[model samples]
Target chain A: MDHNKRYEICFSKEKDLGEFLKEAKGLNYSSFVFFEINDVLDIGEIETDFRVFKGIEIHKKDIGDIKSDISTYRSKVDYLAVKARDNRVKEVLSKDKRVDCLVDCFGRRNDFDYVVAENCKRNDVAIEFNFGKLLRCSGYERSMLVRKFHRSLKLVRKYGSPLILTMKPSTVFDLRGFREFFSLIKSIGFSKEDLIYSNNYFKRLIERNCEFDKDEFVEPGIEKV
Target chain B: MRFRKPSLEDKKRYIGFYIESEERLGRKEVLNELWSTGLSFLGEAEMAETGFWVHDCFDDQLIVEVRDGYVDEILAVVSLVNEIKNERVRLDLLGVAGTIRKLKKSFILNQEK
Candidate 1:
């Protein structure tokens, strides 16, 4: 993990892709990951120094359907995020190596707990702290979400699990720099060290995916000897 | 009048921030939202304790001066001010310094990159 550089993962609408890249670079993000919300997939030719990545985010769906979607999309993209609304889905995704991130832990207090945290840690599925969702709410709802965040971070830290942070920015305005992101979440018990680990874990994820994509690679332990 | 010793003087910090938004933002609108956000997040007691103040906002950058020990608290509040006048905005911490002059010279003007 180059501590000097930071990375962000955000969601983008089709029209905002160009400006999103510009804002991300201006904010000093070394890398930007995008999960297109719509059919705006013309992302091939953006002239910029920053490394851009494309990903898939699966929202709340039936367990069997979600599993099929995961299998279908997992190998195709370097990043796969599953929104596990059901505990069964969460359990399945927690142990699934194909899924890079398990999200939608916004169900007040029922979503994430110690068991999920431990399983995610043991199986290497990262639990995500989606910041853009937090930015969209206000008043009581926002405060309630922050309280849930406080609780969730406590459980995540207690289990020593891998944590990842993403903005899910729909527009350019939703993106934020590293320090500000750190400070805002720190109030809810996230530490600077945790932030570094999250960012570095993400960095490693990209590298590992790149290696996994090469023709010579078979799986984690063995290459095509 | 016996001045408080330099060592005993209240140490301060100036936090430089860049506001990222689609439209232009003015100091008045930004400051108003900041105060409200800080007040709501920290409440009146902590807000008073930190003694937060905005030095200036220009060219989409702003400097917030807070007590040395309270920098993080003020930062949290500033980060929470995600909107100003119905416009979505993001506040990114550019840098923080012991003096406003250094913060301005290094961060606002951004001589070093």
Candidate 2:
């Protein structure tokens, strides 16, 4: 899959949003996933104006497990899911049809159109795996997490919903080319076909949401995957 | 800029340093000499009231209101110390969790530690 096809940008600070919007305007990708922290609500204010802003993702890292002290982590994942739904409900109730999709960063809690399932079960949303984080853990841990992750992918296939593969890269060095991405996916026991499906699904979502013209969408060249 | 492992007795002193960086290192050195101990960092909380500027080093350099002009380096150092202290607290939590898990297993086995 082409690196350009799986483009995603995450913004934590408000200033980065403007920079991202300006940069994304010049890109030829069909869809762009923008993950924003809840504190920076101003980005949402300018959402409609940004032509390339396909979907808005808000991450609430609250997975209420007693083992981890994730308390300080803003927006619990489940709470964020509900909040996104509520926002969607309110938008629809107001008769505003601009917002097409609301994606929950982690797994789904109530009702969400898309979910990013990392080492967890899948529902209506898409499953995204951080291959780097998985590989960083011990081999045993990696295998265990992969088993759970693969199960989630299977659910996505059965449900016939879209799936997206993301690196969740915080820095530029984390970016990978097509070959590296394919090899990493293969190492995690995912088939070539699964990788292709994820790439296509992600592209379609971007195309639909971004409203990119046919000429604007760049077709990613497939490698061995 | 530099970190050293505090002695067992100095743990408490270091904890004080973690909380209050106002004291000079001489005070810490004197405490280490008297008690032969060090302090452990518990954790850090963001100074919500402080205004900060991004420094060239990519660390948040806080603006500490002093007598006249603001001291940027001092605020940055204090913030870093607080961060280290907070990390220590997180480690302490992880340690507690591990201990609890072990105790639970031991209890199930009808064993006393």
Candidate 3:
């Protein structure tokens, strides 16, 4: 039976595009989202069955800086992810419609709560869950991190925020198959339907971003005549 | 030790998973990581109660047995293990079944192919 297996978009900074593509293909991912546009050049040179997309991840401490950065990089990248260093910046960016993804909620603290969840839902900003965190941490800190993720997931569910699962792998060694990812999240309390939704969300993001890149597309709702 | 009746015994689930890595890992390394991760996360007392076992281990794929209610915990432990002997690795879970026979028949054959 066909399981309708999900396609993963790995965010990698690894310089060797050929090796990265080989690893990603082995992991069954059809796409790789690079953190910078420069790394994406060699991707075109390598003959592969994977689609590469440029993404910009900004780490900002203030809302003003974030707003300016978003404006500068919004049209330049296919995916715009923000790692808010301050809780206030996170709150503002979570509610900002221009922000595509709000990641690294566990940067300094467990930055998720009912309020942030609500804002993300209202703005349609995706709440990203990175499995790489679980890989790095262990013992008491890991337990606490798991609890924080559980609590955040509860709030995200209650407010109905879009959920995104990412590996954020820096190298080929960090890549993982979709089933491995699902198993991790499934243990964290997400249902099978939720897993399916996460996959669909990534697929939709790629499609939407591709549409936005078109010259004929004027904006979210407008088009050139 | 007195054996419990079949109905009195706890129901179990078998999880089929494969290790994703370039280097081939031995069964010992896989078990070591599994126990280390499981013990660190769930603690020894809780892990013992889960009745975890490596039902079968192949070159790359393996089937782990766990108590019905504790499958999630086992999954958490397995997924958290990204390294073994300082080598990077990833565990991709294929499927879970009530019986090892069923799990193999349904998932193992397909994966082997």
Candidate 4:
């Protein structure tokens, strides 16, 4: 593996796709995962020189709705993320292997229990750490967010749950280079190697999805060559 | 003057980084804001221990000198600085070295490329 390469798994609601792609190249991001793609934003019309992956974020009220959204969008998108705000939603998302990631663990009010962590490990759903919150929040809120992340990190370590690092950039301003992203997460007790592991998880996710899309692919362990 | 012991000398690290923004920024502006933000994020006691200094600034690029073991804390503080004077900006790390010579050889020389 080319260890120098860094992958950004989430960039959301980009206004100018073309410009963002150019910037992404300059930043040396090997791959980018853009969320909430629509018809107006044509992926084909734009360039695909960089490894770009499409993802849909599920922000629903209940677990049932989240599951439905995941099922609906799973095959269509390269990555699928659920915005887990509370324990109930987190629990529901964690138990499902189809769900790729569970994000927003440090929302205004959220719960991250050991059971949820173990569930994520069991089901292979990665827990996301968005550095955008660290950039945006300050004072007491930022401290609380850091503490929450620490708690989550501890649980993740204990349960061996996959951890993914995303900038969660809404605008170009929020976009950060790999080193900056690495340093920020490193400060939060995430080692550089952990960041690499998380990115590899996303890479594997994309590869798995691509395999399923192939015509010869029949089922798990049964592919028509 | 008596020669200072190597062990007694502060084991400092030179970190090379650059700022990305729409408009060009003066060195003073970037340095001042970095210090202020560092103070705010790390507070007085921690900031003092960090011994952070803007050793050099050219164009949008800056080389910051910080004591060893405090680089990550200083980096965390720098990441928190998203905006300066209401202008959006990002501080990206280039490389870190124990001495200025190596840092320049690696980051400064290749910065143009």
Candidate 5:
């Protein structure tokens, strides 16, 4: 599958949100997902907008779950955002269909169904792991984090869709195009085949969610072997 | 903990550090200088009475605790400046003060990558 086919941008601030929405409009990206931290004002206001699929980060209190705060937030969000401590909470939230994506901050766990393995068949939920931050983390922390992330990916593949790779770049300097992204993933232990499948999965999600006139999009020719 | 006066070199580093000062140097030169160095800038009431400022900097995401009487506070500022200069280190200065004593070298260097 052509890696260029899949694309989704997560925006954390209001300014970036406005900028990306405008850019997506011009580019006519078929599907886009918007994530906002729950504290941001006017979160409910964005839900009505058709330009993007909206996901909000809600704390554990908002979701009525005693799991890790991060998992509670993930459960309430359209895209579940899990931090290092929230693995157990994420297990409970995965059962809900409202969660279309699961973002693991430390890339520790990958099981899409059941808190522990052997509960049910796997289902696909988009998973994102940040290589840049992991690389900058302490050597011990990085190795431990990556090992967990890889394990998560294996579990996801066996139970659900393969893991989705993301850079989670907080600043403009962190941005990388498709080629750079593929190379980075390779450096971080993803095989060429895994990279290709991850890209295809993301593209499919975008196509499934984004709505645009067929004529406006120049389908990047992608082939599956 | 017994307070140790900062060495001249430490003082120089604290005073010369380039942080945004609150106002022109006047009645509170030391206070303003500390504030300029990006200390808490606790306002007159907080500064004269408590000798600390409670302000957030670095795009307002960090919540720092600054006490005027504490040399560790100045040292904390120096550490923050160094960490910010090195992009790879992700220490939240404000969060640090809230969670630990600002003066402990180990506390500042705990997560330095």
Candidate 6:
């Protein structure tokens, strides 16, 4: 609360994690969540001055497969994300409190409307703003990506949904410090208040998920079947 | 060494920065790319007001001079510059100061040595 919004998510599948963590810490991040599950990439024993969490991202396309994967990996991981292309599947994941984030894999055909954004807000599921592709492309490709992001940002702001901004870095060089990251998002129309809102949401997400061992934990807005 | 009145002169800032690259880059290439990227982000009119200049750059330690009230625009421009000559790079802010002397003393000098 006293400091900047210095939390991040690294989706790196590479093994050069030592350099990544060093760059992250040097760039003034206080905490980071890694969304890869490989045991070989473990940095638990590494003497780091920042917090790191193990997260799992489910890429199942079928609705049934997604539900199964969420249940299977929900408890095993500190954070859980699902990529759903079907609107119905997106709705299902939005309504499911067990899911932490919903990754928008649907490309330029952008399917995230006001309804999806509102649903995510109602369910507390965060929408990711991945700048990896943006950084990789140039000219027309980058322009189109920026246009797509503007549309998503408009909906996210209107609905007050929990939003997470990340570069989706796969390497140390791909990473950016908090200042640069914030500036990039701000250029896309994200306001300072939006950044603060995101910071508080992450704090809450981490606080609730910290007690993962207990069975009594209940996600807000969930009802008994 | 008669100088113009302080109030009549332009107020500029020497902002310190660093470029982390996959390989060493030339001064002209780096500035050319930065100016190009900065122009795209700031547009022609706003960029003219910036009075932007790459005061000195060595071993990726960069110091840029810009007009006042445009610091965030500079940061945003620097942030958007992800590539230079097809090499992926990251630009980070070191600090901001009113003069080159203080900027070197505070941000770049110690790190370089």
Candidate 6 C-alpha lDDT tens digits along A1-225: 435746777776657666678766667777778886322125466568777777877877688877887777777777787876677888778888888888863465647777778889998899887776766666687787788878888888888888876777776777776777777777767777777777777767876677763565565444245
User: lDDT per model, in order?
Assistant: 0.78, 0.34, 0.77, 0.80, 0.42, 0.77
lDDT of 4 by residue, B1-113 (tens): 89999999999999988788889988888988998888767899999999998999997788999999988888878877888888989887788999999999988788753
Better candidate by TM-score, 2 or 6:
6
What CA RMSD would you report for each candidate?
2.5, 20.1, 3.5, 2.5, 16.0, 3.7
**DockQ category of candidate 4:** medium
Q: Chain A in model 5: its TM-score?
A: 0.60
Indicate whether candidate 2 or candidate 6 has the larger DockQ.
6
> Model 2: DockQ against the native?
0.01
Q: In model 6, which regions exceed 4 Å deviation?
A: A37-44, A215-225, B1-5
lDDT, residue A36, model 2: 44
Candidate 3 — which residues are off by over 4 angstroms?
A: A1-3, A7-9, A26-30, A37-42, A62-64, A107-110, B1-13, B22-24, B68-70, B94-113
lDDT (Cα, tens digit) per residue for candidate 6, span B1-113:
99999998889998898888879989988899889887776688989988888899888889999998777778877877777888878877788899999998988876642
TM-score of each: 0.90, 0.37, 0.82, 0.90, 0.46, 0.87
Best by lDDT: 4
Q: What's the DockQ of model 6?
A: 0.56
- Local error of candidate 4 at residue A68 (angstroms): 2.6
In model 2, the runs with Cα more than 4 Å from the true position are A1-5, A9-32, A39-55, A60-124, A211-225, B1-113
Give each candidate's interface RMSD in Å: 1.7, 17.6, 2.3, 1.6, 15.3, 1.8
- Can you list each candidate's DockQ? 0.61, 0.01, 0.49, 0.60, 0.02, 0.56
- The TM-score that candidate 5 achieves is 0.46
Clashing pairs in 6: none
lDDT of 4 by residue, A24-114 (tens): 6656578877787321123556675777777777777777777777777877887788888887888877898888888887666667889
Write candidate 1's Cα lDDT for A1-225 as tens digits: 467567777766647576567656756578877775312234677877788877888875687877887777766676778877677778878888888888886575456877788988988889888876666777788788778778888888889888887676677667666667777778767788888888889999988987888898987988986
